[model samples]
Target: MNNNLGLHETLELHELLLFKNTCLTKANTLSEVAQDQELKNILKADAKASQSEIQDIQKFLS
Candidate 1:
């Protein structure tokens, strides 16, 4: 990859990591007060997706 592209990828990966952390935090918070099962499920799915993205970005950065 070009140097500029690599830099962009790195920044993107960092952003992904931050986003994933935010999702995980929201999921945990919702779990504590969640009354709707469907909502909980959706939040869980989002957290899982974010986690998967983080893993993919980490692998790409390596």
Candidate 2:
């Protein structure tokens, strides 16, 4: 299987990385003010996963 990204694919990945970063930021910020314990835990988990995904995307880009 091919592992290289084409120009279009690279651009799309860049966009996805940006969107993920936004999601991570929102998840972190919302978790701070979340009233429900379950909701806060969910947001924290999302943020952690997002961070890992962001690192993977960055590695691919590099």
Residues 4-26, candidate 1: write the lDDT tens digits.
Answer: 45776778778877877888788
Candidate 1 scores a C-alpha RMSD against the true structure in Å of 2.7
Q: Which window of 10 residues has the lowest lDDT sum in candidate 2?
A: 1-10
Stretches of candidate 1 off by over 4 Å are 1-5
Taken over the whole model, the C-alpha lDDT of each candidate is 0.76, 0.94
Error of 2 at 58 (Å): 0.7
Candidate 2 regions exceeding 4 Å error are 1-3
TM-score of 1: 0.70
State which candidate has the highest TM-score: 2
Per-residue lDDT for 1-62 in model 2, tens only?
11687888888989999999999999999999999999999999999999999998888888
How many residue pairs of model 1 clash at the backbone? Answer: 0
